[model samples]
Target: LIWAAIHRIESGLNDFESQDIIVGTLGLLFGLIIANLIGLAFARLPIIGAYGPIVFSIVFGYAGMSIAIRKKSEIIALAGNLRLGKSGKDHGSKHKDMEFSGKLLDTSAIIDGRIAEICSTGFLEGPLLVPVFVLEELQLIADSSDLLKRNKGRRGLDILKQMQEDNYIEVRIINDDFDDVQGVDSKLVRLGRKINAKVVTNDYNLNKVAALQGVAVLNINDLANALKPARIPGEHMNVLIVKAGKEENQGVAYLDDGTMIVVEDGQKYIGSTVPVTVTSVLQTSAGRMIFVKIANE
Candidate 1:
């Protein structure tokens, strides 16, 4: 337990940037001083007088830490105003210089494997950061007892290896990791914030968490969804009716891209490819569905 506590302390120290620590320390000190002064007034209150200073110190100290960390750039800028172009630097820190810092790759993104292709096309420019901790997570998955997970891990490793070998894509191995952050997702988010890089991932929960924490995330699944072409009514295509639809006498087929094709009164056409003319297209929460009839029918 003592060793565990020490490890946690070490991680916390390692995770915090020097600037943040310095600013946060200053804020905490000022907060504590203000709290003690306020506590002196509360000391006159009969019931909780003795504990007022302690309560105020804890509350203000925490508030100070939160505000300092959240507005560290502002504070730094204010300090710079004593000598430099403070406001411009503050604005540009978030917008200008950070834009091209890099894209941090999560383990899931590596496993999905489209990133390498995307990188090859010369569209995704910036350093492709494959963090050491993420690699460790991938290694752990590769060694998992479950065969499916192990296979995925191995595949991810292969994809990463291939990306590294590619000349066009600069796959940078990032050694910076947060030991204090328990999960890989949390660490990834933390690292993204620290480096001011966009996280490249497909995990929905990670996307939400990163957004909530004010870290930009490039979700591959969202990208794929956006890139899916819009299907309109009256489009004709060939599809194979693989099974009966849930509706009466309806045949179910799928396009090569996996969009559902519902064939009207064509249940008997199962196990065969058929030319279908699109009657209508419906967008549902589940996915896109194309309703069609047999060609020329």
Candidate 2:
């Protein structure tokens, strides 16, 4: 209205674009700017100015009330959603009762690095979850000063790339993060608990922590343990001892499965395949350690 009134006043003059007209236009614009600022200032005052405060309070108050009401309603809805009968927690509990086939791979598992071969073997079933934090850790390792760590990180990335390319494995980069958790291992445990998924890792400390939390963990070492070929005591096998063990006349040979075989009185059999009888097998948390004795050449 102010602009219209100003325009009307200007229109009454014949010379619209002359110096006099330009001066009037500038004066009107400056008046509008000053008036708007004054109106804003008056609107902020407790009980001053005409109409500005009352109008502003009514408009803003109604808007704020509507927003507050809506927020209250949303909070009620969310509370309802959190109930036992209708909660996401109940749904998750139901899922927990069922067999979860999915696996969450940790950064260490990927870097300790047998996952690619394990996946290639076609035995690792279900989707593989690589959390966003795990990826960040891998990237950090790839940027590390240690050559071994850098190589491991690059290898992990390469394995993921190959898995994606081959379509032999399913991959999901989960974006969930636990702000309260300080480390990726803890976040992984929380994620596994939340989703009722199994964690695949090769870290000994992580395995212990997961067990303590009662979360299911598929330790690569344990998998390797279960996958090792069963060797019975007194069973005969051929091995080539490469080095002497710490004990006297104890020769050490490694099997195809990376199982260390300790042979008694077989130091002369070093670098040569010789028949040996398995005397005993020690099954530890990590894997099997076979103690053998040379029975014949």
Candidate 3:
């Protein structure tokens, strides 16, 4: 029984790994120290001294431990700040560069057609850098045999033209191209690193790759999802059932901004507009999805 208990404890510790265990142990130690100090203050009381100190110790110790464990991230950050202060060196310039850095527009963001609107809102500052390689990729898509690809490419070009003409934001065409990097996404990452700029893209793959390469990314899809009005259960909205969904008695529709809605028992209502009560909302990396049911039923 003793060996089994030890094995269980070891397994539980393993679930937390190295940093978590260290933080938890430190938290417990700090809690115990605080409890001891508080207990000492109550030790002189005549009537309450006997049990008061003991009770206070236990309560204070547990409270401190729980607080420290819950706020481990904040504690770690505070420790980091203290260590940085002790080093006595200013690193403000490094952070300042990142703060005012230009935004590198990826082909995916341009084609998404929301960046222009976002910029027009005056939220995004600094010059919008459009790499020459991205333009080439857009041209290739525009000349593609696929009709969908051609139209998307044309739309991207139109968006770019509109941004250039808009007086609110500056759009600069960067001539920098990497011969070593074969993929456009890779090139964007490299350019972002070189210029200390953030890559603006809606492509999930590109977003992941840029992050892996230590390049900052501003995903347009993420922005769109964040800007969407919050919907809660029981809220009713009118939606046209466009097509059938994967599940039985389900139909799919889309909002004006392309947020997908899955309606229950809506397959029969296709081609007609009907009221739907929001059952739930699922926000994913790609976009937001609303699960609904027919309002009447």
Candidate 4:
């Protein structure tokens, strides 16, 4: 009987996430605090009084655990707001929820086209929620008078269709437009909060804005950059300098992945495959740049 109980407890623990554990523990502590306060007042009740503290402890502890686990998302968000208040790091958006939470796709992410590929690769799991407002925006862009916007809009729509056709993928087109929200970006942020989903976007401005509002964001560009090969100082490679860089005595080459390498004083070997040694690497929201000099230099 003892071993079976232990095994059951172990199984229950295995199903809980780390966040759940932390929140549960905190809830238990608060519950114990409240229980002791009440027990102190009731301790003079003779027989019941003798066991008041013990009884209160168990009752409060269980209540706390049940309430905390059920309201985990709200409690977590409240914690985030408190931390943000103290740190003052951001405009103080609420912290991101669990990684496995649903992703709310913005127009930019949909139009970028890479999201479809990323989804197909199985790297991004969970239902992809496309808000009706975002779909309407896509439709507007697709029907635009400008040829460029029209093509991009149509491409985004086609990508959505492609994703929907895949049997294993889950795509949800939700109708949750916050009419009070002034812009699509704002609506996306609002919807993200309402649904506890992360706003998936590649637009830098939207990323910043959504973050400022405490809405979670998953930038496709950020993922692409992280997956690129790391280029550290002193790494050596050979490349044919393709063209002159914007600065003097700077020639440019590119990695097969499209990362730019600026070679110092390498104009002389524009067409020649010369060995080079990396001096430094610069990464930014835009992309990565590697600075190198001729291997012999």
TM per prediction: 0.59, 0.64, 0.62, 0.65
Local accuracy of candidate 4 as per-residue lDDT tens digits, 190-255: 877765679889989999988898888899888999999888899999988999999998999999
How high a TM-score does candidate 4 get? 0.65
> Mind giving the per-residue lDDT tens digits that candidate 2 earns over 1-297?
999999987677664324334444444454455555667888656566777745655555455444433233233233443453355464666632443566889998887768878887898896787888899999998998999989988988887878778777877665567788999999999878766678999888899899899788888898889878899987988999999999998899999978999999878779989989998999865678999998763
Superposed Cα deviation of residue 124, candidate 4 (Å): 1.4
In order, candidate lDDTs are 0.82, 0.76, 0.84, 0.84
Q: What would the per-residue lDDT of candidate 1 be over residues 1-297, giving only the tens digit for each residue? A: 999999998898897777778988999998899999999988989877988899999999989887887666446545644433444566564433334347889999999989988888898886687888999999999999999999999999999888878867777675576667799999988877765679999888899999999999888876665567876678877888999999999999987767888999879999988888889987632356789999867
What's the CA RMSD of model 2 in angstroms?
Answer: 16.4
Which one is best on lDDT? 4
Off by over 4 Å in 2: 1-96, 120-122
What ranking emerges by TM-score with the best candidate at the front?
4, 2, 3, 1
* Reference-based lDDT, residue 285, model 3: 67
Given candidate 3, what's the lDDT at residue 240? 99
Q: What pairs collide in candidate 4?
A: 93-214, 94-214
- Clashing pairs for model 1 are none
**Reference-based TM-score, model 3:** 0.62
